[model samples]
Target chain A: MEVINIQGTDDTPNVILDKNNNKFEISGRSLPEDVNMFYEPIMDWIDGYAEAPNEKTEFNFKLEYFNTASSKIILDILLKFEEIVESGHDVKIKWHYHEEEEDMLEAGEEYADIVEIPFEYEAYTD
Target chain B: MENSHENHSFLDFAYQLYRTMKTNEISLVYEGEVTQDITKTFTSLTEKSLAKSEESNAVQRKVFNVMVECLQNISKHADALSEEEDERRGIVMVSKGDDCYNIITGNVIKNGKIPGLKENLEQVNSLDKKGLSDLYKKQMKEGRISDKGGAGLGLIDIAKKTGSELSYQFKKISDEVSFFILTSTIRRNN
Candidate 1:
């Protein structure tokens, strides 16, 4: 699987999906004016990756902030991973949020509640 | 002798009240050259308002998201209201009340857009929470980016976050521009 990397802006987040290393990372602020355009390819890549087997799939989300629309799309991506896990693929999600931001931590918890993927949350000072 | 009983401090008393009211309502107004710079000020004001309310994290996030969308809506679509050439200018005010926070944004709208803006607000006012969520999800899926504006999700997002109906008015300023005032309130969760 080829890697995909997109830069973040004031509105969108950077998405890095390293298929070869089995590590996926999405970080930065996400408040896109048109959220679907920003998130569509990330979703598509995850969908395709689900079909192929990897040794381990680790998805890390380090988001400073994202709008509600982007939040829903992120949920959709997590749900897809849940399905992949159900199909017996080893998958996990690491949610990194700012230490002071309880909102981001709660958001991660909300997604974890709905999906079956093992979600681990870590806090950073920066 | 009867004229001597007339009140002499009427203007002074009224001026005192005016000062008190002005103090209670904090105003942070900005007039800038860049559209993006103007948006940053608005965004910071919104965050400060939300923090003052001390709402839960979820509610605060919702408010912030709606705020971003609304300001963007104004930046991209509102008619120029200031002397800045080729730059959009509008007013966004956040005032604290006893039990609610008031967010008021005023901008100039071109004559033709009045109907569409009115229609969207009317539709948004009619939806319940669940319905608005479903509608927002649907719009996110179908709404496309255009040169004109965003996914048209600004009003819906504001309505959903505020849990209050959007209030707006269109007043004729001239043949070319109309004043559009949009007000949304977030009630304190008890």
Candidate 2:
């Protein structure tokens, strides 16, 4: 499958999906005015990627900030990965959050609890 | 050089509001369209101000997070009748009290939306932190998210962050609109 690469902006996250390299990641601050508009394409890409699923997929999320709207979309993205795992594709999620941010950590844990993906949390200090 | 009585009264009203805000110990305020650009500007400005206040990292995060939610609530949910430019105008402020920090936001909402909004706020206010967290997890699992990216999660998140009952008021501005003010508080000790 062809790689899907979208650059990040001040109000949106960067997304990279490559079935060839088995690489997938999203990182940045997400506070789009029209969240559905911003997320639709990524959702489409993920749905397409699921058709020809990669043998192993590791999705990294390094979001420094995101609004509640973006939060819902993030959960949807994680749930899509669950679909891949259900299809016998190996999938994992790495959630990177600031070490001091208990809020972000709990947010990661919340996603991990609802989804079946082997979610690992990596914390960093400033 | 003209000291009209109407102008004097207006100045008095402005001074009264200034005094009220000062008395509330407000550190930040923005009274205009709550656009994405404004959110970024206010968040960064508040970040700098919070740093100067020497607040703990956790407090700063809570304040900033809750502030962002309130601002988004205005941008997403607030309404305007017709195409008036000021219809999108909103009021957002951050005040430091002795016990907690208050993030207050106000915007015009259609009179029709008042009942449902009141119900939603009351439902969220009725829950405690644990209850709110459980509700958040349940909603997340159930995938009750809306197309606009909120399933009443923002209010729940604010309640969770504030650790207190959400406070709000509605002032009827016209037959078609009401000015809605919502305030969430984060305890200083937290």
Candidate 3:
């Protein structure tokens, strides 16, 4: 498995998924110019990784903000992880939001209910 | 107040607003090729405008996000092939009002979308703060199975950001297309 990095933009977020260090994270603002174009590579990479898979896959999502289009893509990514877990891989998602942002905390809970994988919510102060 | 003469050109509309801003000496206008491009343009415009006067950065970001969401909503759902639409191909205007920022977005909505728009917006406007928050969570859990395009979260975000209710109107152009206008307001902090 190989790691991929996409830098954040004024309208989009930064994505860093490193297979070597076993660290996968998505952070920053996420209102992309073309959401499909921006997320396709990330989706493809995850699909490829789930084939060989690791002992446990931990996804760290720390988004300061994201748009509606992005919410769907995040759901799509989590659903793919559910498939990986169904195949008996250990997978957990750590959903982080700013301590003051209650909306984001609830958003994490919503995704947790939709996907099969366990999602742990954490609030952090910047 | 709406113009009863019904001028459909975006340039005409922009010029009108531009004249109003020049008199006040405290606003900016932005144009771009796409919805996201235009959003970035307006984001910078707002940031620079506010920073010039040394306004609150946090409040400016919230207002900017609300403005961007309103614009994107028009770009994603606006009806196509209209001659009146601007060169960027959609009409989203953000102007500085006396004590607030006003966003006016014009788009074309297909006939089928009007019913859903009315229903969802009605539900949104009817909800209290707690109710809207709960509805946002509920919709998120159910996913985007019913949306015409995306998760239909923009309106909710707009509502939350400004703490203002959405105001909309639909002008029937033909059997298939109706001109949709959405207006949202953000109060400026002194």
Candidate 4:
């Protein structure tokens, strides 16, 4: 699969899905006005990867802020990863938050609670 | 002379509105078409302004998230007046009090829609934090996104992030429509 690299905008996140390196990372603020239009491509990419995922797939989310619409899409992304894990690949999700962002931390926990994936928390002092 | 006088009065009215907003602790207020570009610019400005005075990035983020949701709500659901269906007829305001930040948004709606709007809001207001969390998770799994790409969790997210009950009202503008006002508050200390 070819790598998908999307640059971050003020209202959307940067998405980097590197098939060769086996790294999938999404970061920055994502509150796109049209949530579906913004997330549809990423979902499509994941749909393709789920059929034949890497042996060890790692995903990282470092969102500073996301609206409710983006929140649902984030969950959809994680649920797709569950398929990758179900196919026998080891999957790990790293949820990052600033030291003072308790809400972000709690948000990660909420997703972890609902999904059947292990989530690691990394806090930045900034 | 008449045109110059009209311009001067318009300026005077704007200046008075600015003074009134400042007196009420409002840091930002925007009334115009709630387009995507406006939503982005408004949210960014609000984020930068909140970051300057608040210490916790968490609170700042929460505030920003709530503001985005409300502004987008305006853009998506605000009733267009007529033929052209312009995304106007909306107002968004932000005020910082000593203890909290208030994000208030108002948009016109067909009068008949008030009942459904009130019911959804009341249902949201009835839930506690845990209940809201559970409801949000349930709605997320439903996968029934609105035409505007909303997940039907706008009110729930606002309640969860702010740790405060939502307050709203409907001001009747005519027999067929009204302007809905929604106010969400985020605390300075958590």
Fraction of reference contacts reproduced per prediction?
A: 0.09, 0.50, 0.28, 0.78
Tens-digit lDDT string for candidate 4 (A20-111)? 89889999989887788988989999999888888888899998888888988899899999878877889999999998888889889889
Q: Which is the leading candidate under TM-score?
A: 4
| Clash pairs detected, candidate 1 | none
Sort by DockQ, best first: what order? 4, 2, 3, 1
Chain A superposition TM-score, candidate 3:
0.97
Q: Which ten residues in a row have the lowest lDDT in candidate 2 chain B?
A: B143-152
lDDT against the true structure, per candidate, is 0.73, 0.84, 0.76, 0.87
* Candidate 2 lDDT score at position B77: 82
Tens digit of per-residue lDDT, candidate 2, span B1-190:
3669889999999999899889989878778888878988888888888889878777888888888888878877888744564447789989999888988899999999999999989888888866888888876666555644555678988888778899999999889989999989998886
Off by over 4 Å in 2: B4-23, B81-86, B141-150
Cα misplacement distance, residue B131 of candidate 1 (Å): 0.8
Cα RMSD, each candidate: 7.6, 2.8, 6.1, 2.0
TM-score (C-alpha) between model 3 and the true structure = 0.74
The runs of at least 3 residues in candidate 3 whose Cα sits more than 4 Å from the true structure, single-residue gaps closed, are A85-89, A99-102, A116-126, B1-19, B22-34, B50-58, B80-88, B95-101, B110-113, B129-149, B171-178, B186-190
* Candidate 4 displacement at residue B107 in angstroms: 0.4
lDDT-sorted candidate list, best first:
4, 2, 3, 1
* lDDT at position B2, candidate 1: 48
List the per-model TM-score of the A chain. 0.96, 0.94, 0.97, 0.97
